[model samples]
Target: MSEANTALSDERIKNTSRLRTALIRPELGGICGTIIVFALFLIFAGDSGMFNSQGVMNWSIVSAQFMIIAVGACMLMIAGEFDLSVGSMIGFAGMMIAIFTVTLEWPVWQAILVTFALCIAIGALSGYIVVRTGLPSFIVTLAFLFILRGFTIYLPQLIERRTIIGGIDDAAEGDWLAGLFGGKIFGGLFQWLGDNGIIATFERGTRAGDPVVDGIPMLIVWAIGLVIVGHFILVRTRFGNWIFAAGGDAQAARYTGVPVNRVKILMFMFTAFCATVFATCQVMEFGSAGADRGLLKEFEAIIAVVIGGALLTGGYGSVIGAALGALIFGVVQQGLFFAGVESSLFRVFLGLILLFAVILNTYIRRLITGER
Candidate 1:
């Protein structure tokens, strides 16, 4: 009898171990995808300068752009909400900044600050409508998507008589606040590397010996900073617990005094903040803003978040995984160009990956809930 009991106990332990492994399987999807992307790109584009300093910078910047938005989307999705207006918000914010500085002749810093405030307020309003009306966030944000995009195009044409605005760089010259978004970091380090023959340097002309890559852009910095802060909040705080609770089961969370409405609203505002950050960095880097900027970026952000292992039903995800998903996007998008592949194939890849992620997440959810 005692021997029989021991056998049963051992079997239960093994089953528990298997269950734990299954629980974590979905979260590893992003990490595995990132590794595979890097390996493939290295094999196909290794000799194409895709791994060089400048090439790395190119992909890194693109990844950072994705990462900035992914962070917000991940958090919001984990809280059981969607923000489809993010892409439109980016265009709207950039256009507003251009209009403020160039057309209105306002100070660059003032324009940027005001744009951020307006964007955040709009985000809050979106959240308010959702919480108060009990409408799905998807529908609510989708409405704002069109509304904001329309303004993005119409405002520029109405004021400047064109859809594209310029003169931002000139207006922002010597502006202290603009530097935070537009400036680069670690220039001396890169210069040293070039001087010591570490990185490629220009060999001819008045700029001879200058490093091919100068420094890290502020966009990358913002990406890393947001990721760190987001990860910390999601993994380490009472508020984080509330977020998960709010998304997992709003009714139950409210029973426990979780303030579900407040959490959701705040998350919407954060999503807007992230989108504006991307916009400011982009406009600064390009020295101009267009109505067409950030087209389809909202879907890209959602795809990245899904690839990062967040359940469509909400309450499960990792910020680190989302960052990895964004990295995969950056690599594959740039890798196609370097490998001489057609660019349009990227959309096909996105569709396939998103479908796979959704299927995997569904399976994981069933496992956790003991559903067939």
Candidate 2:
């Protein structure tokens, strides 16, 4: 009887392991999505510039914003918290930077420092409320989203009686910021792409094709660097283990001396820091971050993280997967444009993709938790 039981146990363990291997492989799903996207473009808009040089750069330039924010949101989600106010935070930080640098005539670095300090305070307050009250992060962050959003538009409008804030002095006018954040330097890379004879149609075969211009936007590089750093902290270090433990079972982690509250605080701070970085990028891209600079951006970040295979309930996710998910997102958006789909209708398509991603994520999640 004992021998028979041991054999059954071993069989079950093997099955469980196999299930995990599949569930954790979101990068595989990402590859499938890539193929699907590429094929759709080829069939529907084969004549579009998507196969060209400059057309490729368009998406890379646009996607840097989404990819960077998505990477940070992924880390926060994996740590078992959420930040709905990120979009508002962006506008607020940008507006504040303008106010300090332009309206108040402060130096750029000083304005940035103040903005960082403010973001940290807000993050700390949010974390304190969530951890102490045991309220849902959704509810707490939802309130913040509204408060910050209102302040962003109304405060400026109340003072100026207009929705826009212009006429401010350009405190730092040497074009240094733009050169660093918005320039391109991959002439050699684009030459390599065309020489490969892989595909060409869009861009008029324009020269700036490497899919990332200005020598790979500073923001994307920062996001990638963050991924490496976050991955290191999560896997090669002790803090990562604690994050998994805390998210997996808060009560148990506390009993194990995991410093759960401190972790929660730090996660919030990380998100706020990301918001500040996003604001800086927006300024570099547009020369200004308006009161309405980042509308619905927070939702987009959350969607990217979820699509990257993070669990809705927390405890499992991959930063690299989220980065890949962001790439898929950028491609689809640009693909629709290249394929001649109405730009206004792109959101509906995005909604469908998110739905599909979530469904896949949920099913895989069920298999892992033994609920399916």
Candidate 3:
């Protein structure tokens, strides 16, 4: 009887240990939070068809837009930095693309290539300044934020006397490079579904044969591709290790032979590259750019990263978690409309979620690290 009791006790101890380990995973908090938000929205918004094909596509598309920058922001945060200028960078890039292609009549591809190169240079410059000055990134990026935002507004007005730039769609017409970046894929599958009644079609309209659900948007494809690549780099590559080490302890990382400064500079450039990609996608989809485009996006990207279980101080995070965080934002942002809540109230919801997520994440980190 004593032997049997002892065996049962040992099994219980092993089970408890396994449960604790699972609970302490960095992404577990994000996963649970996403599920809860999804469930709540589903219960309240089911009749609004948020789970339907069209609704799914709508939210997923918006989420992809957020995820691209959020992934970059997550990586940067992991390496102990911030870029408040990302939102302005988007606006600037969009405007540059428009001016290059429309006002100057440069080829769309050339304009795009030039814009990307310039963006990288800007990022590298910012990183260099931060490293050389030993200044906090918040202050440095804040300055760039205003500078870039001012340029985005002033440059267009000075040249064209207006804040909006158009004609991109016309320039992209028949351009294979533009099509590659902005074009949709899997037309046959959607067409077949629409034809065979597997997917819904427009009812009683001139476009009656068109499928309500077309091919997946390019933005979503890019988001997923980047997320996978980011996850791989973070989890399975040497650079990822360098990123964590740099953020965790810059001095120690340098002492240990890591190129901390180079890693950070590259991360900064990568973040800028992501912002440009987002700008490219939006400009392509809408066929225009505006000075006010991408406003406040920097905060949203950071919020997504924080909600993804990445610490603000750096050194701990997961790209998959950031993706999930974007998903939660998408669900809430769209779900609120479906649930008939006022759009203005969404900020309140975000504030509350961010607060709670920070608290939960902090507690979980402590548990995992065995800190009081």
Q: What's the lDDT for candidate 3?
A: 0.90
- The superposed Cα distance between candidate 1 and the true structure at residue 253, in angstroms, equals 0.6
Instruction: Give the residue spans of candidate 1 off by over 4 A.
Output: 1-14, 18-26
Error of 2 at 339 (Å): 1.0
Worst 10 residues of 3 by lDDT: 7-16
Candidate 1 pairs with clashing backbones = none
Per-residue alpha-carbon lDDT of candidate 1 for residues 244-332, written as tens digits (9 for 90 to 100): 99889999999999999999999999999999999999999999999999999999999899998998778888889899989988899
Regions more than 4 Å wrong, model 2: 1-12, 15-20, 158-161, 166-170, 174-214
- Candidate 2 local lDDT, 1-372, one digit each (tens): 788776655544554465568656755566677678778887887777776656666776566677777876777787788899889889888877767776676776677779889987898899889999999888998899989888888866776555555532355455554344444455466556555655442354564443333245666666667768876887678888887776777888999899988888788888888887888766655666578888888988888777778776778877777766777788788888887778877899789888988888888777667784
Let me know the TM-score candidate 2 reaches against the reference structure.
Answer: 0.84
Per-residue alpha-carbon lDDT of candidate 3 for residues 3-75, written as tens digits (9 for 90 to 100): 8776655544434476678767668867998999888987899879888878888899989998999999999
TM-score of each: 0.95, 0.84, 0.94
lDDT of 2 at 140: 96
lDDT of each: 0.93, 0.74, 0.90
Question: Using TM-score as the measure, which candidate wins?
Answer: 1
Superior candidate under TM-score, 1 versus 3:
1
RMSD of each: 3.1, 4.5, 4.3
Query: Model 1, residue 180: displacement in angstroms?
Result: 0.8
